[model samples]
Target chain A: MEFLNQNSLYIVLIITVICWFGIFGYLLSLDKKIKKLEEKINKE
Target chain B: MVFKIILGIGLTLVIIAGIALPMVSNPSSFFELPVVPGLEDKARIIFFHVPTAWVCVIAFITSLIYGIQYLRTKEILYDIKSVTAAGLGFLFCILATVTGAIWSKFTWGAFWNWDPRQTSIFVLLLIYGAYFALRSSIEVEEKRASLSAVYSIIAGLTVPFFIFIIPRIVSSLHPDPIINPQGKIHMNPTMLVIFLSSLTGFTAVYYWMFNLRVRFSKLLYQQQMKEQE
Candidate 1:
Protein backbone atom coordinates (compact mmCIF):
# COMPACT_ATOMS: atom_id res chain seq x y z
CA MET A 1 0.00 0.00 0.00
CA GLU A 2 2.78 2.44 0.84
CA PHE A 3 4.61 1.52 -2.35
CA LEU A 4 1.53 2.10 -4.48
CA ASN A 5 0.92 5.47 -2.83
CA GLN A 6 4.41 6.54 -3.82
CA ASN A 7 4.13 5.13 -7.33
CA SER A 8 0.55 5.84 -8.39
CA LEU A 9 1.43 5.96 -12.08
CA TYR A 10 2.22 2.26 -12.00
CA ILE A 11 -1.32 1.61 -10.84
CA VAL A 12 -2.65 3.38 -13.90
CA LEU A 13 -0.25 1.45 -16.07
CA ILE A 14 -1.35 -1.82 -14.55
CA ILE A 15 -5.02 -0.98 -15.12
CA THR A 16 -4.40 0.07 -18.70
CA VAL A 17 -2.47 -3.13 -19.39
CA ILE A 18 -5.19 -5.29 -17.87
CA CYS A 19 -7.78 -3.56 -20.01
CA TRP A 20 -5.70 -4.07 -23.13
CA PHE A 21 -5.27 -7.74 -22.30
CA GLY A 22 -8.98 -8.13 -21.77
CA ILE A 23 -9.73 -6.59 -25.13
CA PHE A 24 -7.02 -8.64 -26.82
CA GLY A 25 -8.26 -11.84 -25.27
CA TYR A 26 -11.80 -11.07 -26.42
CA LEU A 27 -10.58 -10.47 -29.97
CA LEU A 28 -8.65 -13.74 -29.99
CA SER A 29 -11.66 -15.70 -28.80
CA LEU A 30 -13.86 -13.98 -31.34
CA ASP A 31 -11.39 -14.87 -34.04
CA LYS A 32 -11.44 -18.52 -32.99
CA LYS A 33 -15.22 -18.59 -32.94
CA ILE A 34 -15.42 -17.03 -36.36
CA LYS A 35 -13.04 -19.60 -37.74
CA LYS A 36 -15.15 -22.38 -36.25
CA LEU A 37 -18.30 -20.90 -37.77
CA GLU A 38 -16.65 -20.56 -41.15
CA GLU A 39 -15.69 -24.23 -41.07
CA LYS A 40 -19.18 -25.27 -40.09
CA ILE A 41 -20.72 -23.20 -42.85
CA ASN A 42 -18.31 -24.57 -45.42
CA LYS A 43 -19.15 -28.11 -44.45
CA GLU A 44 -22.91 -27.49 -44.72
CA MET B 1 0.83 -15.59 -39.02
CA VAL B 2 4.23 -13.88 -38.88
CA PHE B 3 2.54 -10.48 -39.01
CA LYS B 4 0.34 -11.27 -36.02
CA ILE B 5 3.29 -12.47 -33.98
CA ILE B 6 5.31 -9.35 -34.77
CA LEU B 7 2.34 -7.10 -34.06
CA GLY B 8 1.70 -8.75 -30.71
CA ILE B 9 5.29 -8.38 -29.60
CA GLY B 10 5.63 -4.85 -30.98
CA LEU B 11 2.43 -3.61 -29.31
CA THR B 12 3.40 -5.13 -25.97
CA LEU B 13 6.72 -3.35 -26.10
CA VAL B 14 5.02 -0.08 -27.00
CA ILE B 15 2.71 -0.25 -24.00
CA ILE B 16 5.55 -1.03 -21.63
CA ALA B 17 7.80 1.72 -22.98
CA GLY B 18 5.03 4.29 -23.13
CA ILE B 19 3.96 3.83 -19.52
CA ALA B 20 6.95 2.61 -17.56
CA LEU B 21 9.57 4.98 -18.97
CA PRO B 22 10.86 7.64 -16.58
CA MET B 23 10.07 11.31 -17.12
CA VAL B 24 12.70 13.95 -16.33
CA SER B 25 13.17 17.70 -16.60
CA ASN B 26 16.13 17.14 -18.88
CA PRO B 27 16.22 13.94 -20.92
CA SER B 28 19.93 13.19 -21.30
CA SER B 29 19.42 9.60 -22.32
CA PHE B 30 17.26 7.51 -24.68
CA PHE B 31 15.21 5.89 -21.96
CA GLU B 32 13.93 9.02 -20.19
CA LEU B 33 10.98 11.14 -21.35
CA PRO B 34 11.09 14.95 -21.10
CA VAL B 35 8.30 16.16 -18.90
CA VAL B 36 5.86 18.63 -20.36
CA PRO B 37 5.52 21.63 -18.02
CA GLY B 38 1.78 21.55 -17.46
CA LEU B 39 1.42 17.77 -17.79
CA GLU B 40 4.02 15.71 -15.99
CA ASP B 41 2.98 12.19 -15.20
CA LYS B 42 -0.40 12.65 -16.87
CA ALA B 43 1.32 13.20 -20.21
CA ARG B 44 1.66 9.44 -20.38
CA ILE B 45 -2.03 9.28 -21.27
CA ILE B 46 -1.15 10.58 -24.73
CA PHE B 47 0.22 7.20 -25.87
CA PHE B 48 -3.06 5.46 -25.06
CA HIS B 49 -5.69 8.17 -25.56
CA VAL B 50 -4.48 9.64 -28.82
CA PRO B 51 -4.29 6.23 -30.48
CA THR B 52 -7.95 5.54 -29.80
CA ALA B 53 -8.89 8.82 -31.46
CA TRP B 54 -6.50 8.09 -34.32
CA VAL B 55 -8.01 4.63 -34.83
CA CYS B 56 -11.48 6.18 -34.79
CA VAL B 57 -10.50 8.46 -37.64
CA ILE B 58 -8.88 5.64 -39.60
CA ALA B 59 -11.94 3.45 -39.19
CA PHE B 60 -14.19 6.30 -40.28
CA ILE B 61 -12.11 6.97 -43.38
CA THR B 62 -12.16 3.25 -44.18
CA SER B 63 -15.92 3.28 -43.76
CA LEU B 64 -16.09 6.20 -46.19
CA ILE B 65 -13.99 4.41 -48.80
CA TYR B 66 -16.11 1.26 -48.60
CA GLY B 67 -19.24 3.43 -48.75
CA ILE B 68 -18.05 4.96 -52.01
CA GLN B 69 -17.26 1.51 -53.35
CA TYR B 70 -20.72 0.31 -52.44
CA LEU B 71 -22.28 3.22 -54.28
CA ARG B 72 -20.18 2.66 -57.37
CA THR B 73 -20.43 -1.13 -57.48
CA LYS B 74 -23.94 -1.55 -56.05
CA GLU B 75 -22.62 -4.61 -54.24
CA ILE B 76 -23.92 -5.94 -50.95
CA LEU B 77 -20.43 -6.99 -49.91
CA TYR B 78 -19.22 -3.43 -50.11
CA ASP B 79 -22.18 -2.37 -48.02
CA ILE B 80 -21.26 -4.96 -45.44
CA LYS B 81 -17.69 -3.68 -45.34
CA SER B 82 -18.81 -0.07 -44.93
CA VAL B 83 -21.18 -0.78 -42.04
CA THR B 84 -18.65 -2.95 -40.24
CA ALA B 85 -16.04 -0.23 -40.53
CA ALA B 86 -18.51 2.32 -39.25
CA GLY B 87 -19.40 0.08 -36.32
CA LEU B 88 -15.74 -0.24 -35.40
CA GLY B 89 -15.30 3.52 -35.74
CA PHE B 90 -18.17 4.06 -33.32
CA LEU B 91 -16.60 1.67 -30.86
CA PHE B 92 -13.26 3.46 -30.99
CA CYS B 93 -14.91 6.86 -30.81
CA ILE B 94 -16.60 5.83 -27.59
CA LEU B 95 -13.32 4.56 -26.23
CA ALA B 96 -11.64 7.86 -27.04
CA THR B 97 -14.45 9.79 -25.41
CA VAL B 98 -14.36 7.77 -22.24
CA THR B 99 -10.59 7.94 -21.97
CA GLY B 100 -10.58 11.67 -22.62
CA ALA B 101 -13.28 12.20 -20.05
CA ILE B 102 -11.29 10.31 -17.43
CA TRP B 103 -8.16 12.32 -18.21
CA SER B 104 -10.17 15.51 -18.07
CA LYS B 105 -11.44 14.83 -14.56
CA PHE B 106 -7.89 14.72 -13.31
CA THR B 107 -6.37 17.53 -15.40
CA TRP B 108 -9.15 20.03 -16.08
CA GLY B 109 -10.97 19.64 -12.73
CA ALA B 110 -14.13 18.43 -14.42
CA PHE B 111 -15.25 15.48 -16.47
CA TRP B 112 -17.25 17.48 -19.01
CA ASN B 113 -15.93 20.94 -19.80
CA TRP B 114 -17.48 21.24 -23.26
CA ASP B 115 -14.10 22.31 -24.59
CA PRO B 116 -13.84 22.69 -28.34
CA ARG B 117 -12.21 19.27 -28.73
CA GLN B 118 -14.72 17.70 -26.40
CA THR B 119 -17.67 19.40 -28.08
CA SER B 120 -16.48 18.41 -31.51
CA ILE B 121 -16.09 14.76 -30.54
CA PHE B 122 -19.52 14.83 -28.94
CA VAL B 123 -21.07 16.12 -32.13
CA LEU B 124 -19.21 13.46 -34.09
CA LEU B 125 -20.64 10.75 -31.84
CA LEU B 126 -24.13 12.05 -32.59
CA ILE B 127 -23.52 12.11 -36.33
CA TYR B 128 -22.30 8.52 -36.39
CA GLY B 129 -25.00 7.47 -33.95
CA ALA B 130 -27.61 8.63 -36.45
CA TYR B 131 -25.93 6.60 -39.15
CA PHE B 132 -26.64 3.39 -37.23
CA ALA B 133 -30.17 4.51 -36.46
CA LEU B 134 -30.74 5.22 -40.16
CA ARG B 135 -29.40 1.78 -40.98
CA SER B 136 -31.68 0.00 -38.51
CA SER B 137 -34.81 1.83 -39.66
CA ILE B 138 -34.73 0.61 -43.23
CA GLU B 139 -35.61 -3.07 -43.74
CA VAL B 140 -35.10 -3.25 -47.52
CA GLU B 141 -31.61 -4.33 -48.50
CA GLU B 142 -30.88 -2.20 -51.58
CA LYS B 143 -32.51 0.96 -50.28
CA ARG B 144 -30.77 0.66 -46.94
CA ALA B 145 -27.38 0.24 -48.59
CA SER B 146 -27.73 3.20 -50.95
CA LEU B 147 -29.04 5.63 -48.36
CA SER B 148 -26.54 4.66 -45.66
CA ALA B 149 -23.67 4.86 -48.13
CA VAL B 150 -24.58 8.43 -48.99
CA TYR B 151 -24.95 9.27 -45.30
CA SER B 152 -21.55 7.79 -44.39
CA ILE B 153 -19.83 9.77 -47.13
CA ILE B 154 -21.29 12.99 -45.80
CA ALA B 155 -20.49 12.04 -42.20
CA GLY B 156 -16.91 11.17 -43.14
CA LEU B 157 -16.44 14.49 -44.90
CA THR B 158 -17.37 16.23 -41.64
CA VAL B 159 -14.90 14.14 -39.59
CA PRO B 160 -11.80 16.08 -40.60
CA PHE B 161 -13.60 19.34 -40.04
CA PHE B 162 -14.64 18.41 -36.49
CA ILE B 163 -11.50 16.56 -35.42
CA PHE B 164 -8.86 18.75 -37.12
CA ILE B 165 -10.26 22.08 -38.18
CA ILE B 166 -12.67 23.18 -35.44
CA PRO B 167 -10.35 22.26 -32.58
CA ARG B 168 -7.61 24.37 -34.16
CA ILE B 169 -9.64 27.38 -35.23
CA VAL B 170 -10.87 28.02 -31.70
CA SER B 171 -8.64 28.31 -28.65
CA SER B 172 -9.39 25.79 -25.93
CA LEU B 173 -7.79 24.39 -22.81
CA HIS B 174 -6.65 21.36 -24.77
CA PRO B 175 -2.90 21.05 -25.25
CA ASP B 176 -1.36 21.87 -28.62
CA PRO B 177 -1.81 18.98 -31.04
CA ILE B 178 1.24 17.07 -32.28
CA ILE B 179 0.81 18.92 -35.53
CA ASN B 180 0.24 22.44 -34.25
CA PRO B 181 0.09 25.75 -36.10
CA GLN B 182 3.89 26.05 -35.85
CA GLY B 183 4.09 22.68 -37.64
CA LYS B 184 6.66 21.39 -35.17
CA ILE B 185 6.54 18.46 -32.79
CA HIS B 186 8.04 19.57 -29.47
CA MET B 187 8.52 16.06 -28.19
CA ASN B 188 11.66 14.21 -27.11
CA PRO B 189 12.79 11.86 -29.87
CA THR B 190 12.26 8.88 -27.62
CA MET B 191 8.71 9.94 -26.83
CA LEU B 192 8.02 10.62 -30.49
CA VAL B 193 9.19 7.13 -31.44
CA ILE B 194 6.97 5.53 -28.80
CA PHE B 195 4.00 7.67 -29.86
CA LEU B 196 4.39 6.74 -33.48
CA SER B 197 4.84 3.10 -32.57
CA SER B 198 1.64 3.21 -30.53
CA LEU B 199 -0.21 4.75 -33.46
CA THR B 200 1.03 2.07 -35.85
CA GLY B 201 0.24 -0.74 -33.45
CA PHE B 202 -3.27 0.52 -32.73
CA THR B 203 -3.95 0.97 -36.43
CA ALA B 204 -2.80 -2.59 -37.07
CA VAL B 205 -5.12 -3.85 -34.35
CA TYR B 206 -7.94 -1.91 -35.94
CA TYR B 207 -7.19 -3.58 -39.25
CA TRP B 208 -7.32 -7.00 -37.61
CA MET B 209 -10.63 -6.24 -35.93
CA PHE B 210 -12.04 -4.82 -39.14
CA ASN B 211 -11.13 -8.00 -41.02
CA LEU B 212 -12.76 -10.19 -38.39
CA ARG B 213 -15.91 -8.05 -38.45
CA VAL B 214 -16.20 -8.00 -42.23
CA ARG B 215 -15.70 -11.75 -42.49
CA PHE B 216 -18.34 -12.39 -39.86
CA SER B 217 -20.76 -10.05 -41.60
CA LYS B 218 -20.17 -11.77 -44.91
CA LEU B 219 -20.86 -15.13 -43.34
CA LEU B 220 -24.07 -13.85 -41.78
CA TYR B 221 -25.18 -12.45 -45.12
CA GLN B 222 -24.57 -15.76 -46.81
CA GLN B 223 -26.52 -17.62 -44.13
CA GLN B 224 -29.44 -15.26 -44.54
CA MET B 225 -29.48 -15.78 -48.30
CA LYS B 226 -29.46 -19.53 -47.82
CA GLU B 227 -32.40 -19.27 -45.47
CA GLN B 228 -34.34 -17.17 -47.95
CA GLU B 229 -33.93 -19.76 -50.71
Candidate 2:
Protein backbone atom coordinates (compact mmCIF):
# COMPACT_ATOMS: atom_id res chain seq x y z
CA MET A 1 0.00 0.00 0.00
CA GLU A 2 2.78 2.39 0.93
CA PHE A 3 4.66 1.61 -2.28
CA LEU A 4 1.52 2.07 -4.35
CA ASN A 5 0.81 5.45 -2.75
CA GLN A 6 4.36 6.85 -2.93
CA ASN A 7 4.69 5.84 -6.58
CA SER A 8 3.00 6.76 -9.89
CA LEU A 9 -0.43 5.26 -9.42
CA TYR A 10 -2.16 8.40 -10.63
CA ILE A 11 0.01 8.56 -13.72
CA VAL A 12 -0.90 5.03 -14.68
CA LEU A 13 -4.54 5.68 -14.03
CA ILE A 14 -4.55 8.81 -16.15
CA ILE A 15 -2.81 7.10 -19.03
CA THR A 16 -5.26 4.23 -18.98
CA VAL A 17 -8.28 6.51 -18.85
CA ILE A 18 -6.96 8.55 -21.73
CA CYS A 19 -6.27 5.47 -23.82
CA TRP A 20 -9.73 4.00 -23.30
CA PHE A 21 -11.32 7.38 -23.93
CA GLY A 22 -9.49 7.74 -27.19
CA ILE A 23 -10.76 4.37 -28.26
CA PHE A 24 -14.28 5.21 -27.19
CA GLY A 25 -14.28 8.51 -29.03
CA TYR A 26 -12.95 6.96 -32.20
CA LEU A 27 -15.48 4.12 -32.28
CA LEU A 28 -18.36 6.42 -31.34
CA SER A 29 -17.55 8.83 -34.15
CA LEU A 30 -17.43 6.01 -36.62
CA ASP A 31 -20.83 4.83 -35.44
CA LYS A 32 -22.23 8.32 -35.89
CA LYS A 33 -21.04 8.40 -39.46
CA ILE A 34 -22.78 5.11 -40.02
CA LYS A 35 -25.99 6.43 -38.52
CA LYS A 36 -25.86 9.41 -40.82
CA LEU A 37 -25.45 7.10 -43.79
CA GLU A 38 -28.34 4.94 -42.65
CA GLU A 39 -30.60 8.00 -42.62
CA LYS A 40 -29.48 8.91 -46.12
CA ILE A 41 -30.17 5.40 -47.33
CA ASN A 42 -33.61 5.48 -45.77
CA LYS A 43 -34.37 8.76 -47.51
CA GLU A 44 -33.51 7.24 -50.86
CA MET B 1 -28.79 -3.23 -23.58
CA VAL B 2 -29.51 -6.82 -22.61
CA PHE B 3 -26.75 -8.18 -24.77
CA LYS B 4 -24.37 -5.60 -23.46
CA ILE B 5 -25.24 -6.67 -19.95
CA ILE B 6 -24.62 -10.29 -20.88
CA LEU B 7 -21.32 -9.35 -22.44
CA GLY B 8 -20.41 -7.40 -19.34
CA ILE B 9 -21.18 -10.37 -17.15
CA GLY B 10 -19.21 -12.69 -19.39
CA LEU B 11 -16.23 -10.35 -19.42
CA THR B 12 -16.37 -9.98 -15.65
CA LEU B 13 -16.35 -13.72 -15.22
CA VAL B 14 -13.42 -14.06 -17.60
CA ILE B 15 -11.36 -11.49 -15.69
CA ILE B 16 -12.19 -12.98 -12.33
CA ALA B 17 -11.66 -16.55 -13.45
CA GLY B 18 -8.44 -15.96 -15.38
CA ILE B 19 -6.73 -12.90 -13.86
CA ALA B 20 -7.64 -13.10 -10.20
CA LEU B 21 -6.71 -16.75 -9.83
CA PRO B 22 -3.08 -16.38 -10.95
CA MET B 23 -2.54 -13.10 -9.09
CA VAL B 24 -3.47 -14.56 -5.71
CA SER B 25 -0.93 -17.38 -5.83
CA ASN B 26 2.51 -16.45 -4.41
CA PRO B 27 5.00 -18.65 -6.26
CA SER B 28 3.07 -18.46 -9.49
CA SER B 29 2.34 -14.75 -9.04
CA PHE B 30 5.95 -13.82 -9.62
CA PHE B 31 5.53 -15.24 -13.06
CA GLU B 32 3.91 -11.88 -13.76
CA LEU B 33 7.12 -9.99 -12.95
CA PRO B 34 9.84 -8.81 -15.37
CA VAL B 35 12.79 -10.35 -13.48
CA VAL B 36 12.45 -13.64 -15.31
CA PRO B 37 14.99 -14.13 -18.09
CA GLY B 38 14.15 -15.06 -21.71
CA LEU B 39 11.63 -12.22 -21.45
CA GLU B 40 8.99 -14.47 -19.93
CA ASP B 41 7.63 -11.44 -18.14
CA LYS B 42 7.14 -9.61 -21.42
CA ALA B 43 5.20 -12.60 -22.64
CA ARG B 44 2.42 -11.07 -20.54
CA ILE B 45 1.76 -8.83 -23.51
CA ILE B 46 0.82 -11.98 -25.39
CA PHE B 47 -2.69 -11.49 -24.05
CA PHE B 48 -2.84 -8.03 -25.59
CA HIS B 49 -0.33 -7.66 -28.41
CA VAL B 50 -0.44 -11.12 -29.92
CA PRO B 51 -4.21 -11.39 -29.82
CA THR B 52 -4.68 -7.88 -31.16
CA ALA B 53 -2.12 -8.53 -33.83
CA TRP B 54 -3.83 -11.76 -34.69
CA VAL B 55 -7.15 -9.95 -34.66
CA CYS B 56 -5.61 -7.50 -37.06
CA VAL B 57 -4.54 -10.42 -39.16
CA ILE B 58 -8.07 -11.74 -39.00
CA ALA B 59 -9.37 -8.32 -39.98
CA PHE B 60 -7.12 -8.09 -43.04
CA ILE B 61 -7.80 -11.65 -44.06
CA THR B 62 -11.47 -10.81 -43.67
CA SER B 63 -11.01 -7.86 -45.98
CA LEU B 64 -9.23 -10.04 -48.48
CA ILE B 65 -11.95 -12.68 -48.21
CA TYR B 66 -14.69 -10.19 -48.90
CA GLY B 67 -12.64 -8.52 -51.56
CA ILE B 68 -12.47 -11.80 -53.40
CA GLN B 69 -16.13 -12.37 -52.69
CA TYR B 70 -16.82 -9.02 -54.33
CA LEU B 71 -14.70 -10.00 -57.29
CA ARG B 72 -16.71 -13.17 -57.83
CA THR B 73 -20.20 -11.91 -57.01
CA LYS B 74 -19.60 -8.19 -57.62
CA GLU B 75 -22.11 -7.56 -54.86
CA ILE B 76 -21.88 -4.05 -53.41
CA LEU B 77 -22.46 -5.59 -49.95
CA TYR B 78 -19.27 -7.62 -50.23
CA ASP B 79 -17.30 -4.54 -51.29
CA ILE B 80 -18.65 -2.55 -48.36
CA LYS B 81 -17.77 -5.37 -45.96
CA SER B 82 -14.28 -5.55 -47.44
CA VAL B 83 -13.58 -1.87 -46.84
CA THR B 84 -15.07 -2.10 -43.36
CA ALA B 85 -12.73 -4.97 -42.52
CA ALA B 86 -9.76 -2.95 -43.75
CA GLY B 87 -10.70 0.05 -41.63
CA LEU B 88 -11.16 -2.08 -38.50
CA GLY B 89 -8.00 -4.03 -39.31
CA PHE B 90 -6.09 -0.79 -39.55
CA LEU B 91 -7.37 0.19 -36.11
CA PHE B 92 -6.26 -3.12 -34.57
CA CYS B 93 -2.91 -2.81 -36.31
CA ILE B 94 -2.49 0.58 -34.70
CA LEU B 95 -3.40 -0.88 -31.33
CA ALA B 96 -0.92 -3.73 -31.81
CA THR B 97 1.80 -1.28 -32.82
CA VAL B 98 1.12 0.99 -29.85
CA THR B 99 1.04 -1.90 -27.37
CA GLY B 100 4.17 -3.44 -28.89
CA ALA B 101 5.95 -0.08 -28.91
CA ILE B 102 5.23 0.45 -25.24
CA TRP B 103 6.25 -3.10 -24.40
CA SER B 104 9.49 -2.70 -26.34
CA LYS B 105 10.15 0.68 -24.77
CA PHE B 106 9.93 -0.71 -21.26
CA THR B 107 11.91 -3.89 -22.02
CA TRP B 108 14.42 -2.65 -24.62
CA GLY B 109 14.76 1.05 -23.67
CA ALA B 110 13.74 3.33 -26.57
CA PHE B 111 10.06 3.78 -27.43
CA TRP B 112 10.57 3.34 -31.19
CA ASN B 113 13.51 1.09 -31.99
CA TRP B 114 14.11 0.27 -35.64
CA ASP B 115 14.27 -3.44 -34.90
CA PRO B 116 13.22 -6.02 -37.44
CA ARG B 117 9.87 -6.53 -35.66
CA GLN B 118 9.15 -2.83 -35.35
CA THR B 119 10.17 -2.04 -38.92
CA SER B 120 8.10 -4.85 -40.40
CA ILE B 121 4.91 -3.92 -38.52
CA PHE B 122 5.36 -0.34 -39.65
CA VAL B 123 5.71 -1.49 -43.24
CA LEU B 124 2.54 -3.55 -42.82
CA LEU B 125 0.73 -0.40 -41.73
CA LEU B 126 1.96 1.43 -44.81
CA ILE B 127 0.76 -1.31 -47.10
CA TYR B 128 -2.70 -1.36 -45.51
CA GLY B 129 -2.88 2.42 -45.53
CA ALA B 130 -2.18 2.40 -49.26
CA TYR B 131 -5.12 0.02 -49.74
CA PHE B 132 -7.41 2.78 -48.52
CA ALA B 133 -5.62 5.37 -50.61
CA LEU B 134 -5.98 3.29 -53.74
CA ARG B 135 -9.67 2.84 -53.08
CA SER B 136 -10.09 6.59 -52.77
CA SER B 137 -7.98 7.32 -55.84
CA ILE B 138 -10.53 5.70 -58.08
CA GLU B 139 -13.99 7.26 -58.26
CA VAL B 140 -15.75 4.47 -60.08
CA GLU B 141 -17.25 1.78 -57.85
CA GLU B 142 -16.25 -1.46 -59.55
CA LYS B 143 -12.80 -0.21 -60.47
CA ARG B 144 -12.07 0.86 -56.92
CA ALA B 145 -13.17 -2.46 -55.39
CA SER B 146 -11.26 -4.59 -57.90
CA LEU B 147 -8.04 -2.60 -57.53
CA SER B 148 -8.21 -2.57 -53.75
CA ALA B 149 -8.96 -6.31 -53.79
CA VAL B 150 -5.71 -7.06 -55.57
CA TYR B 151 -3.77 -4.88 -53.16
CA SER B 152 -5.42 -6.45 -50.09
CA ILE B 153 -4.50 -9.94 -51.29
CA ILE B 154 -0.86 -9.04 -51.95
CA ALA B 155 -0.51 -7.10 -48.72
CA GLY B 156 -1.87 -9.98 -46.59
CA LEU B 157 0.97 -12.33 -47.63
CA THR B 158 3.41 -10.00 -45.90
CA VAL B 159 1.52 -10.19 -42.58
CA PRO B 160 2.59 -13.77 -41.73
CA PHE B 161 6.21 -13.09 -42.66
CA PHE B 162 6.28 -9.81 -40.76
CA ILE B 163 4.48 -10.97 -37.62
CA PHE B 164 6.20 -14.32 -37.29
CA ILE B 165 9.14 -15.23 -39.51
CA ILE B 166 11.40 -12.15 -39.50
CA PRO B 167 11.29 -11.63 -35.73
CA ARG B 168 12.79 -15.09 -35.18
CA ILE B 169 15.67 -14.79 -37.68
CA VAL B 170 17.89 -12.12 -36.11
CA SER B 171 19.22 -12.16 -32.54
CA SER B 172 16.35 -10.10 -31.20
CA LEU B 173 16.61 -8.36 -27.85
CA HIS B 174 12.93 -9.22 -27.58
CA PRO B 175 11.52 -12.35 -25.96
CA ASP B 176 11.91 -15.60 -27.78
CA PRO B 177 10.56 -19.09 -28.49
CA ILE B 178 7.56 -19.12 -26.14
CA ILE B 179 4.59 -18.98 -28.50
CA ASN B 180 6.26 -20.91 -31.27
CA PRO B 181 7.53 -24.50 -31.21
CA GLN B 182 4.87 -25.99 -28.95
CA GLY B 183 5.85 -27.01 -25.40
CA LYS B 184 8.10 -23.93 -25.15
CA ILE B 185 5.61 -21.71 -23.26
CA HIS B 186 5.18 -23.40 -19.90
CA MET B 187 3.05 -21.00 -17.95
CA ASN B 188 2.07 -21.53 -14.33
CA PRO B 189 -1.65 -21.87 -13.75
CA THR B 190 -2.11 -18.34 -12.43
CA MET B 191 -0.27 -16.46 -15.15
CA LEU B 192 -2.00 -18.64 -17.68
CA VAL B 193 -5.40 -17.44 -16.48
CA ILE B 194 -4.67 -13.71 -16.77
CA PHE B 195 -2.98 -14.30 -20.11
CA LEU B 196 -5.85 -16.33 -21.51
CA SER B 197 -8.54 -14.00 -20.13
CA SER B 198 -6.97 -10.98 -21.71
CA LEU B 199 -6.88 -12.79 -25.02
CA THR B 200 -10.56 -13.64 -24.75
CA GLY B 201 -11.51 -10.06 -23.81
CA PHE B 202 -9.53 -8.60 -26.68
CA THR B 203 -11.04 -11.07 -29.12
CA ALA B 204 -14.54 -10.16 -27.99
CA VAL B 205 -13.80 -6.49 -28.56
CA TYR B 206 -12.42 -7.28 -31.98
CA TYR B 207 -15.57 -9.04 -33.18
CA TRP B 208 -17.89 -6.36 -31.78
CA MET B 209 -15.94 -3.64 -33.50
CA PHE B 210 -15.79 -5.59 -36.75
CA ASN B 211 -19.56 -6.03 -36.77
CA LEU B 212 -20.11 -2.34 -36.03
CA ARG B 213 -17.69 -1.26 -38.75
CA VAL B 214 -19.32 -3.40 -41.42
CA ARG B 215 -22.74 -2.04 -40.53
CA PHE B 216 -21.41 1.51 -40.64
CA SER B 217 -19.56 1.12 -43.93
CA LYS B 218 -22.71 -0.18 -45.58
CA LEU B 219 -24.46 2.97 -44.47
CA LEU B 220 -21.62 5.12 -45.78
CA TYR B 221 -21.83 3.56 -49.22
CA GLN B 222 -25.57 3.92 -49.34
CA GLN B 223 -25.23 7.58 -48.34
CA GLN B 224 -22.79 8.12 -51.17
CA MET B 225 -25.21 6.55 -53.60
CA LYS B 226 -28.05 8.69 -52.28
CA GLU B 227 -25.99 11.83 -52.73
CA GLN B 228 -25.03 10.86 -56.27
CA GLU B 229 -28.67 10.33 -57.17
Looking at chain B only, the TM-scores across the models are 0.97, 0.81
Per-residue lDDT tens digits of candidate 1, residues B1-229? Answer: 6777787778888888999999989999999998877778778888988999999999999889999999999999999999999999999999999989988998999999999999999999999999999999999999999999999999999999998899989987777646664532268799989999999999999999999999999999999999999
For model 2 chain B, give the 10-residue run with minimal summed lDDT.
Answer: B17-26
Q: What are the RMSD figures for all models against the true structure?
A: 1.7, 4.3
Score every model by TM-score.
Answer: 0.96, 0.77
Question: What DockQ number belongs to candidate 1?
Answer: 0.70
True contacts kept of each: 0.43, 0.26
What class would a CAPRI assessor give candidate 2's docking? acceptable
Pairs of residues at least 3 apart in sequence or in different chains that clash in candidate 1: none
lDDT of 2 by residue, B11-85 (tens): 555433432222222364444422234454455455557777878888888888888898889798988788888
Best by lDDT: 1
Please report, in order, the local distance difference test score of every candidate based on alpha carbons: 0.90, 0.70
N/CA/C clash count, model 2: 1
